[model samples]
Target: MRAFRVLSHAVLAVTALLAAAVPASAKGEDGAPTEAGTTFRTATAVKQGQKATASASAGDYLYWQFPAGAGQRPTATATVNLADVSARHGAATWRLDVFDGLRRRQPCASGEPEKKAGQQDSSVTLTCTLRTVRPWAERWSDDPLPGAYYLRLTVADGPEEDLGLPVRAEVEATAGDAGGAHAGGGELGAPLHAGAVAEPKDGWTGGWWSDRWLWTGGGALLAALAGIGGYTLTRHPHRFRSRPGAG
Candidate 1:
């Protein structure tokens, strides 16, 4: 019965991990965003395949929010269309930054996060491809977890004349196959995200630690010891008839 119980637990752990690995659903409003938010709190929400457009000054910061689930890789692209290129005196630089639900800046594995636009250029484009989102992550890890993500687009640098220039911006966030990269273990009870109000600490349902890992490690140690003992008992014994050799 003890062995059966252990087997059952191992199966359960594997099942949960496999279930979490399943492809994230493509479920969200299909409508495109009509506008973008200036701050994280007011960030416009967008869905996959939906293009978000906003009209803002060149130096203004635009924010957009999107949902990402485990096993999905998120990529966001932004384009700033210079309505009046002739009004610019020098080149301008644009940047695209991605953040997680915790407001932590996520490192981009690829995509030109920052791009420069020449004086005569009509538009500047920037994009960022992030790591695969995980089902659960260690408290100390900054790994991407399933939850809300935010993208910020802004003109990093440009001439003073281009500061207030009217610009049309478009942003699109899409999820791609993770290609089985950055594999991690474990699962979470819920999708953790940032909240304005702090809930009671005791309100959480799950414990902070995982006993599954501890149990598995202990089982492995016992199995190794048992194997060694069995080998000693099963192998032919060497009868040593040692004579006193005092030279």
Candidate 2:
């Protein structure tokens, strides 16, 4: 009996330590590091290739953010479990919006950014596949640049009763480098992110020169050659000769 008690206590102690080591948020069916933020500033940060999940009311907004480097295209896919089907009275629309670190909404290169789930359906999935992250882009352009990107998932329209009901959301964030073809030549004046930014592994340098500069230089050279030819053809031919055969 004494030996059995000692073994039992040791097992209990080890189990207690293991449970304490795991974060409370990770107790979900699928381990989630943290809860989704309600706003951009409070957005939960997820690492590249990592998945983030949260549970919130159907009416509440869920936000997650991930970092992307130049030359890589970032895509965010979210699966949302609507309120209990029995409580839902009608169809609901869910939207997934992606934004750069600057908070400018990024366009989805693929299909629609929203999905409609029927009242009988328990869940819906939405995805936002963004353009390739460019090394450098014009100031006025909203192109996806190297920096942090945010994901916002919210229920657009739903049954009145289901609005405040509990729901769960899961977001999978991934960034894949598309190679040099997608990267722009001109470097952005500044990264979209404020603090430490993710950069390409090979190295990224911008603001030096781009295809625009090359085009401009080529056009100028062609114009100069054209002007010189026109002058030569229209000018007095005898000006270069020695007085019409005196030579």
Model 2, residue pairs in steric clash: 136-188
Please list the residue runs of candidate 2 whose C-alpha ends up more than 4 Å from where it truly belongs after superposition.
1-32, 188-190, 194-247
Q: Which tens-of-lDDT digit does each residue in 1-247 have in candidate 1? A: 9999999999999999999998554233655665778999978877665788888898988998887766667899998899576688899889999999889999998899999899989998898999887778789999888777899999898888779889988898887655433435677676677333222121222223344556768899999999987787678344333456934
lDDT by residue (1-247, candidate 2, tens digit) is 9999999999999999999998666434544444888999878777677677787998898888877776777788999877777777899899999988889998899856898999889889998889888877777878888777888999898767777888888888887766544546566555668333344343333224345556778899999999987798679655655775674
Task: Judge candidate 2 against the unseen true structure and give its global Cα lDDT, from 0 to 1.
Answer: 0.77
In TM-score terms, candidate 2 sits at: 0.67
Error of 1 at 74 (Å): 0.6
* Candidate 1 structure lDDT: 0.77
**What's the distance in Å from true for residue 30, model 1?**
7.7
- Stretches of candidate 1 off by over 4 Å are 1-30, 180-183, 194-247
Error of 1 at 52 (Å): 0.9
What TM-score, computed on C-alpha atoms, does each candidate reach?
A: 0.65, 0.67
